[model samples]
Target: MYGIKTRLCLSVLFALTLISPAWAQTFDFGEIKSPILFQGNYKYAYRDPAVVYHEGKFHLYFTLVEKAKDKGMYWYTAQSVSEDLVHWTYPKIITPCDRNLNYSSPGNIVRKDGQWIMCLQTYPTPNKERFGNKDSRVWIMRSEDLENWSEPELLKVKGNDVVVEDMGRMIDPYLLEDADEPGKWWCYYKQNGVSMSYSYDLKNWTYAGNAHSGENVTVIRQNGEYVLLHSPRNGIGVKRSKTPQEWGEDEALLTLGQKDWPWAKRRLTAATVVDLTKEKRFGKYIMFFHGSPVNPKNPRSDAHNKASLAIAWSDDLKTWTWPGKNSQPK
Candidate 1:
């Protein structure tokens, strides 16, 4: 029952969702059984979610928060569409509201020229007291299909092209479109550390910088090479560069050591990468991240708790192996 303009666009995104005290409670959080097939909350839906594969079908857009930061009363940014990527077909609300608060979050999707775009980060001004606030801007929207996606203006980000400026770091405006390099659209975003951008016509952008520090940044390019999964502190990391302006810093594939996610929490912050290349394995890759489980004190880990989604494997994205549940799907 979501129609009054998609619940008024999720009631204004909980006034300004930020999340982290661990996301305060209520478990299962949403599937990520290592790498594929999730059914937890209708298959890991919402709370820092972002994924795209268009044309063939694999569009997972999130943020239907009841508390991950409030985002209700008029909060939008929700979507779902997976033909066989394992169940999902319930949410609808797609980016509502426009007095200029510029609805923002970690919703990432990209296509280019023909359309289908989403860069997201939102909030140029609409005080919720999110500290210092650089005004947060990096928005864009246009769609040909993904069920009609529009309304996400202002995305220039010039003057300095921005290199790095994430403090407590929680930025997810990710987007990837380089089926080997066609039209050349690759954007691996984040707030402070992980960054990089390039576009053909997602409304003009060229900020290929950062990728040297380490933080929630997802990017994929199989066989041809280009992998970067960053966040947390130690393990669960990988940063390799070839184009995207030569990212040369990070170097660890999986972390939390000894390997064991009885519950989860090691793989850090919003992430997702897929490029099976016809499911060959080796030159293979699959990584989707988000953590805070492993009984982080059970009370649901609080801070805004609601982070779960896992999967890891890479023979040459610089090495990684968290084969738990053998990439689930039983």
Candidate 2:
């Protein structure tokens, strides 16, 4: 059980720097090499890593989940940036998710009308959901710099009759800022599957609808298109879109082998893609996912940890690199 629970407060680590490892040159994997730029700890249920390269640093915000009196979700973000994607600085827990309230990390850090925005999955506290705020959904926050984040602000929305066994909580938000559609933006959240929307301002979101509902999702605009990478019981899938205006059908991008991969314990869940398709970042695409490939026959069935970060790539946004040996199984 967690000893202390902190509420919605933005924790920040400023100006983090990293250097290339000695094996930097020795490691290579297409445009991205081995000796990964970052290292993840299995200790914290590190899930849904949204990486954004700011200036010269790679800021990766992650979710920290633990079971208190009841299973509750909280988030803390960590950051490390490197000019060259070779080695990353030791990761530090920089931000805190609401320990009391259910505060989850949001999608892309966006700039709108010259102001920065942080879209987050604001879950009702266990007390509130079981008692009040039942119809409530997600929200957004405003930030000028990554250091300071605004309070969790509500999103104008309408709840649906859809839900999974009464675990009534809509979490894991991914946003696309000021979409190509001009002053508009798009956001997606996990509703046992997915809930997508279009918003002109960070607040006042117009619900576009649900995408079947899953555990985690990563929606991105890549190579002149919109794509969704998600985890349904079938493993990890790669979805595509024709333009930022339309999100197309999703297909499994790749699957992790049970005993073959060590980093996973269950099927993939809570996955997300890079911040955006821009110049500050180099690689064609960078993604992080959750799951552990559990060996069905192993009596140590309990050895599985339940989450891990998976990697994948895409150039034209139509097809993604087959995530195979590249999977870092712990």
Candidate 3:
């Protein structure tokens, strides 16, 4: 006969074995992959990735750039779906370059009232000039399904006659549904410094103020506080805020260093954060950003060098760990 303690231990072990599989099934960590999506063709480049999880899969949208002899270079947003976040299936373009407008940067996606809304930046087509152009503006599109999108609607205030302007130009728009205030929406875009606007109905928006001195803003709420991520001249930085209008002092989160992350050689920019607090598997935060290679001959032009997407994991949104054999936060 077995001792009482030994028999009880065995019973507990058997119970865990039976429940382990079900526990794993309950929490789905879809496609946990880095550079989670990339383009193999050298003729084309992919950047500015925005992700949204709906139903049972994650839908990712990114800006695709193709250079053609006759058409010059144009950008549009493409779509991919992943169930595990590790493996993905590329689908057709979700937002395509139309005759007169080019979908340049996909900022973010959100679902409300059983409808999906995507906010992005657009530049006039054929000319394809972004600098000092008055036609550039942030537009919103709606879709019942993630695949089929309606026409782009230029967002504006009730009485405004011109397209919304950030600083002097409009680019990289990020949308956030205000957490503290119900029925309020916030749009943060790149201008002089992360500029912001507020709307009650998602249609008419009024310029609020600058949140911080960075571009490519991504904000998330944690512990009743909001954390903002932006790309400055150096690399990615983090700021905290109790409200959407005011951001706290900036802290250096991730900076480009040759030895730190070789792939992120020259600089880092355009950061997007996904919170997985509800998921039992990850239970942390994932940040995706693009890194540019150093142009040795022209260090001044390094900002416009060839770039690729990279990722980092964070527990409390403060400390981050990169991928390697022995990775630690700086």
RMSD of each: 21.4, 12.8, 4.8
Task: Give the deviation of candidate 1 from the true structure as CA RMSD.
Answer: 21.4
lDDT of 3 at 223: 93
How many clashes show up in model 2?
18
Q: Backbone clashes per model, in order?
A: 32, 18, 7
Cα-based lDDT for every prediction: 0.52, 0.54, 0.69
Per-residue lDDT of candidate 3, residues 1-330 (tens digit): 999999999999989878765324443333343442463233465667788876567787877666556645566788888665566786457666563566867888987678888888875556644231555677788999888899888776322554344335577888888997877888888776888888887877787877556777888898988888887876778888888889867866666333565445666678788897676756668676776665667766524324565566678777765544144345
lDDT of 1 by residue, 272-330 (tens): 56664353212344455555444445643332234444455454555555544444443
Looking at candidate 1, what is the lDDT of residue 273?
A: 61
Off by over 4 Å in 1: 1-170, 175-198, 201-203, 206-260, 263-269, 274-281, 294-330
Prediction 1 TM-score vs. true: 0.27
Best by lDDT: 3
> Candidate 2 lDDT, tens digit per residue, 10-93?
111121213433222232335454312332343445555666666655556655444344543344544444444544555565
lDDT of 2 at 187: 71
Candidate 3 stretches with Cα past 4 Å from truth are: 1-36, 39-41, 98-100, 125-132, 157-168, 256-262, 295-305, 325-330
